[model samples]
Target: MSLIHCPECGNEVSTEAVACPNCGRPLAAPAPTIQRRVIVAEPRDDGFPKWVIAPIAILGIVVIFLLIAITRNNEDEANRTVNVNLATQRRTAEPRDAARDTSPPNRIDVPSSSTTVNPPAPPPSAPAPSYPSSTTTVPPSSAQTVPVDRASVVIDAKIATGAGAIQSVKNEKFYLLDKDLDAILADADLEPIEGNSLADSFGLAVLYPDRYGDFRRDALAAISKHIKYNATTGGDGRAAIKNVEPDSYYLFGITKAKNAFAVWSAPVSITAGENKLNLQPARLNEIAN
Candidate 1:
């Protein structure tokens, strides 16, 4: 309801109001108005939902591992291929070496017999031509001729002491034989020198004289002083040795001449008759003059 105030002693008087209640102040002012404000509250969902990326991160790591595994497998396969090729090469090399080892040509075998055919003989060839057989004569083996060259040589050898003589010669002999294996002649001799001289038993020496009466100034060079005989006696009498090698010759020792020890004979043919060799001064010691 609307109300009024009394001045001085005014007091609120309702539409039919009366005296003031206390202090003579009347409640006559309209009731003061208050503004009311409306406030609305926003509803918030609980704390932030947790991030869900951990599973996706783990998935990425797995994919990376798979890629590495695939790459490693590829590398292993390549290595295996290379190893197989190397093994094949080694296997083939062995047989290649064996084939090379077996390649040399081998000896071949041949059959010994062959077949042949014969036909009936034709009419006898017109009178076989006659030839003279009497004119041709085959020479007897003993009469066969052989050619040889001869050289004559004279040698002088001496031994100063008996001891030296013993050392100088063992046994000596002369030999003569033809190509026909027949003996021509043979002999040997030894003798003593009457007087001796020594500038001290200096060993014996051999000397030679030229056909011109001059002595060989180099005596050793001109003579072979080491002449000796062999003891074997089984050789043929005619040949001195059978089946003499082609063109071989013989030499004989010399005798006489001061300090002479040997004489060399001329090389004779292995032919008939002319094979005689004379051992000078006789086969036994001759009287020294």
Candidate 2:
């Protein structure tokens, strides 16, 4: 029986009163009681606290990363070692048997390494050299290299006089031409004098003044500016040609006379030694103007 305030009038109602007596109003119904509830958590079987899960998960991830890095580093080191071995093999001068070459030197070999590899005991030791034939049996000039790069030439030239007299040509230049003398003098318009003999025509042609200056100029121009060798005759008409290589060449010279000229074209093969040539007025020797 709880006391309550009246709704219609300001009055205190007693324990068993159904209505308020002072205000003649019925009392309001009693208010229901509000109950408080207490809730309890369920127990966990795992002993670890919940706050430690984040740090444990983070530490596990770091350990996994470290293991992965270590594995990758080991793999990279192995790969580098393999690559270095391959580079070493490539730099080798010759292909070697890998198993045989890598073995330790002290390893046992059948039949002994020296017995199989060494040349048959060279008759204990020869009284002579082991080569037996080379050191003592040497040839005299077999190995000496004699240079044949140059040779020499000597020539005697003469022009026929009118009265069947042969005299020495003076101040005449004789050229050693590699090309054919016929080819060189082809462009020159030199008309040979008609006679029974080349010596007779040559003697008769020298009576007049010089008429062969143009032919001489044309012949010199055809042989080019490079002359291998040339020599001028003294008063005796003898010239010595030096430093000529050992080859076939033509000894070409033009002797000027009053009205005619004589040409010497001798195809001579030069050797390592001295060579001599004579240029007298002849039909077979001239073979041309």
Which residue runs does candidate 2 get wrong by more than 4 Å? 1-149, 185-217, 281-289
RMSD in Å for model 2: 28.9
- Tell me the number of clashing residue pairs for each predicted model: 17, 3
Pairs with backbone N, CA or C atoms under 3 Å apart (clashes), candidate 2: 208-258, 208-259, 209-258
For candidate 2, the lDDT comes to 0.53
Q: Give the per-residue Cα lDDT of candidate 2 at 243.
A: 61
For each candidate, give its TM-score against the true structure: 0.22, 0.38
Q: What is the C-alpha RMSD of each candidate to the true structure, in Å?
A: 36.0, 28.9
Q: Give the top-scoring candidate (lDDT).
A: 2
lDDT of 2 by residue, 62-145 (tens): 999999999999999999999999999676623433432443322111110011111112334333211111112111121122
Which run of 10 residues does model 2 get worst, by summed lDDT? 107-116
